[model samples]
Target: MGLGKQDRTKAREELAHDQERAERLPELLRSVAEAERALDEARERGALVEEVHEQGVRLDTALTEAMRAAYARERVLVGVGGYTDRIRRRKRLARPEIKQATQVAEHLLTVREAHRLHGIQQAPRSVV
Candidate 1:
């Protein structure tokens, strides 16, 4: 009903997906291992050249998929409000930019001091 509840529901749904992937990861790993073994056996037997190539391709594809699933499982969120690992970009400032910023700041300070002095000069004086 509320935005906060919606956020929590989304987070829980994501966690459930991750958990499902994790549950299937073991089976995927086994499949990859079996494919590798089959490919090796085909190679050892000197089977048809096309068959060997096909087996090798299958093994490679399975291995890649299994690894991806494992990585996704490992990166799953831990808690409801925890932060996810993310890539951050560093802010780089050129020399010219830094110099211009410093000049602007100095100008602002000078203007502020001038305004303060002006205010002091304009204040009503006490009568003797």
Candidate 2:
């Protein structure tokens, strides 16, 4: 027995919905890309490590949830078995860099202030 016309139409509509979501994949990927670039610049500029890590972790969590949602909606949206690892890697890669940079920047700022104070102390005392 063949699927009734109505059943075939329903299947077609479902496929169409899935395909539309697939079209939205590029936009979603672009969002992740923008976040990555901002993260890199933040690391280079000495943004707070714990804070950056928190944000990155949040993004990673969100992206994973998104991938999971898409997968549940359309399992073929991503490659078989490779869908869950991308965000995890991004999170791991970003945490260390931010931590290192923020620590270095904080140390440098402290050293600068110390040196500035020392220079002030050693300056010849002028008569009032």
* Candidate with best TM-score: 1
Clashing pairs in 1: none
lDDT values, one for every candidate: 0.54, 0.48
TM-score for all models, in order of appearance: 0.52, 0.39
Once superposed on the true structure, which residue ranges of model 2 sit more than 4 Å away at CA?
4-7, 61-128
Model 1, 70: alpha-carbon shift in Å? 0.8
Question: Model 1 residue 91 lDDT?
Answer: 23
Q: lDDT value for candidate 1?
A: 0.54
Q: What is the C-alpha local distance difference test score of candidate 2?
A: 0.48
lDDT of 2 by residue, 1-128 (tens): 44566765665665565556656555654664665566566667877766456546544543543443343334333222223346543454356553453443354345335534431222234489
User: In candidate 2, where is summed lDDT lowest over 10 consecutive residues?
Assistant: 75-84
| Shift of residue 74 alpha carbon in model 2, Å | 8.7
